[model samples]
Target: MPTVAVPQLSVADLDPATNLDAVTERVAALPDRVDVAVFPEYALTGFVADERACDAALERDGPELDRVRSVAAAHDLAVVAGYLERGAGDDRLYNALAYVAPDSDTTVYRKRHLWAGEADVVTAGDERVVVETPAGSTGLVTCYDLNFVGDSAAFAAERVDALFVAGAWPAAHSENWRLLLRARALDGVRWVVGAGRTGARNVPDAPLTEYAGRSAVVRPDGHVAAALSRGERDLVADLDPAVLAEQREFIPVLEATENDGSTRRNSRPGSRNKNGV
Candidate 1:
């Protein structure tokens, strides 16, 4: 069991060159003894209307990623963060989550589902990825993906101990965000860590859309273990795998579902909706 930190900071206009330093500094201040730190989706590149901006995205070995790697190595912690990754052969890009081990190569989890206004520029990933870490087996899913029941079920099938979700979820849909996260935690029967942005983004002629930073960590029992402020902030909490295992054994929800397809085992029934993460 290790503590994981979720950072909910403003992206500061999607400029990675200038923002990476600040982001790194903030991450460095996180609890040094924690096992891992998770950052928001597109934290380096703010949500943009023009998808072409994703083309300018970096590679896993790019400077932006290198900075994150350095932080992980410095702190001796696993690091998970999202960025836009340019495809080598195609013009399209992938919204990717990079899992960097201290002083090691990076593993990537590309977003499998694209959101509205993203089809033109982003390519969808074909499969889910779960990486074995020092702490445990971890799965990565972007914000929109969590809305899909199949995705979480697949992770459950994989027996992932933890799921890391990064996003730019808007304030108008805060309740939806909370519900979706709880649903994922309950359905997957695993720890859920969600890190999202806070503050507003300006659209050309329309009113600004505020990103509600309700970053949180949920237990296997679907209880909120820890949370950050609804505004800009950083928060961390210790996660005890032993406690999670105990709870799973007591409830046996996932096992019951697998054994008999008994709807009686689900905490929430008939709530499956596809809005891919």
Candidate 2:
């Protein structure tokens, strides 16, 4: 079992320096047994829908993330954080998430399903991202991506043991956020960790956006293991590998999904089984 943390943070808009400081402080305060900490979408730069996004974007190899990598190494834990990415030689910015671990090179996953106003600011990613983590093979997705059932199916076909979702979902539509997270977990028979931004955001062009502060960890059976509401706090829980083993054996959603062309299992040979990874 890997101890995972879902931190609901109120981001500092267009201020990477301040948010990065908070990230460092929060993770540094965690107990040694916590294997990974997942932060909300745009945790570093907050939510940007204006020209300021260009000013706020950070390079994957830049100093901002190098500091995060140093923290990961020093603490012996992994960090999943969301930020606006300045892709190399690419004209547009990307809403990307970085998975930084102690033993592996950093893995970056750009948000594929751009939310309503976000498309005007950043380009959507072209492919899916699934990477190995302390919690086993984990798939990364952003806020709007949770609405697409097919994305969850793809992760299911990949036989991911867990899904770490970084969300900046609005407080108005918070119920949909909770429902989708549970559905995704039920569909894949995998754990779903959703870390959402809390409090209010005031940007240049967009209206004052109030984020749903429900940072939660949903078990394979679609039950919430730990959740937080209405404030900034860390929701920590131990993700038991045995839970995946028991759920997959009971439901076998991935095996049933192989019937359709929309998704098919990628052969990992000995990488996974119905009981465990």
Clashes of each: 5, 0
Best by lDDT: 2
Instruction: Kindly list the per-residue Cα lDDT of model 2 for residues 83-164, writing each as its tens digit.
Output: 9998877677999988888753577788888978899989998767777887888888898999998788778877889999
Q: Which pairs of residues have clashing backbones in candidate 1?
A: 14-46, 144-276, 144-277, 145-276, 145-277
TM-score of 1: 0.87
Per-model TM values vs. the true structure: 0.87, 0.92
Give candidate 1's error at residue 98 in angstroms.
0.9
Worst 10 residues of 1 by lDDT: 262-271
Candidate 1 lDDT tens digits, 120-200: 667888767777665467777898998888777767766668888888888889777777888888887788888987878
Worst 10 residues of 2 by lDDT: 264-273
Q: Which predicted model would earn the best TM-score?
A: 2
